[model samples]
Target: MPVLDKFNMVSQGAAGNLCWACVGWSVARYYDNRAGVPPRWSTLCEYVMKAADFLDGISPESTRCCDGERLLDPDCNQSRILPDAFRVSSNQGSVRERALSFQEIKTEIDAGRPVGVEVESSSAGSRAIAIYGYDDSESQKVMVGDPAPDAPDGALIPYDELCFGYRHSDATWNHSYLTVP
Candidate 1:
């Protein structure tokens, strides 16, 4: 058998949404194939977070948070989260991260980095976006910063019918993004 071109997700986890996981793996694969070196799941996840922080010159140690609660803790006061935060179990598949605002994830894409975040919508299913690039909103039209060339659904989903959760929409059906204002 031919070695699969993409990393096979040995197991799928029971979580809110996994599209983000696919997005994460997409970035991992890119580095694996193009960068000539890649980070492990744990390290790759961190690199993604660091890329996000590069915008503000923050370090992983400064932004690391195990969970949303910790990330929001006054003491931790973290601005970022780890893929581990989404991991339901070390034995199971990777967990997906929470949805962050567009502004929160802009820089990573601007720098050619991939980051995951949940996006809210009325549609059913878990959803995550791999932020790739952003269009100047000043143009009066929204443009996507699509990093994953093969994302299941075309990037730039508008809110309204978008709902997130691993099975919110059947994986196949979910790819048909419903756009709204």
Candidate 2:
């Protein structure tokens, strides 16, 4: 779970779920070779929310659904935002998304790239996690940065459990997986 040694992980604190997504973006940009100095967390979050059409520029610190546009937009400059890095192909929905497989997720981690995850939450509607490391063999666990104020930066979850929870059929979690570049 300690694989993310080089990522510039940030906590959302009281900023809310949207802020978590920004943390993911910031991590991605931090790894982008073209990016300059990392921007403030708020700046990254605001930019993402704006792209998602959240015009008010606010982090509600509460559960809410976000427009998927910002996270999935292939045209988005990965060097600047909390949006995910997905490999695009001609397919639909999860099928297209699955191109970045679990092994690829591990490869990204090995290469110092942080992964972005989207998980369902009953209280918060939708939530995001920044994945920095994974125990691929011994425990099959992942190290994640939870943006919630009460959660610590490096929390652990079973790799299979997290992946299973991500499925829409899972009662506790709806979606899970790292979108890699």
Candidate 3:
């Protein structure tokens, strides 16, 4: 059930906003592990950003460093784009939900699915990260694949700290997460 080892953390770089880059990386990891087809993170990121631009008439540049609110919008939602991006059947769709509990996240990880989440960082503002595993031996922590340039792959972060930051963020979509089912 542990999937952290299956994933490779890819940095977002200047390709797009953290939101789209994380989405791209998460989705790419999902397919890479599930199908053994490795998709480029930059290609997936561009696909997502271009889809947003086409649907919402917003320039891709405007999407750079976007907050979660913009990401959750109907036109820009990853749930809406994932099917097309990967050409999956409509029934096997992605979901974006608010305030998912730690247990919910654990359940998904146990199922071997990586989750995309928006967490507020005090110094870095809001960014999206992919959750791949969890540890509850002592203090509960989740294994995260962050898309930040300097972030190492498979970093363990305290679950409580992530929850607190997500809950306290100003964005309405603060505690929201995306899952492909």
Highest lDDT scorer:
3
The C-alpha lDDT values of all candidates are: 0.35, 0.50, 0.57
RMSD of each: 13.8, 9.3, 7.5
Q: Is candidate 1 or candidate 2 better by TM-score?
A: 2
Clashing residue pairs for model 3: none
Q: What is the lDDT of residue 171 in candidate 2?
A: 23
Clashes of each: 19, 4, 0
Tens-digit lDDT track of model 3 for 1-181: 3555666666655434544445554566556667676543334445556556655577878766234323433344344422333332111235554546778777877876676666555655666666788888787788877766767878787777666653344432244444553
Q: Least lDDT summed over 10 consecutive residues: which range in candidate 3?
A: 82-91
**Clash count in backbone of candidate 3:** 0
* TM-scores of all candidate predictions against the true structure: 0.35, 0.56, 0.62
Clashes of 2: 4
Query: In candidate 1, what are the lDDT values of residues 9-35, reduced to their tens digit?
Result: 211122222334444444455445445
Q: Where does candidate 3 stray beyond 4 Å?
A: 38-97, 121-125, 166-173
* Weakest 10 consecutive residues of candidate 1 by summed lDDT: 172-181
Worst 10 residues of 2 by lDDT: 87-96
Off by over 4 Å in 2: 32-102, 164-181
**CA displacement after TM-score superposition, residue 113 of candidate 1 (Å):** 1.5
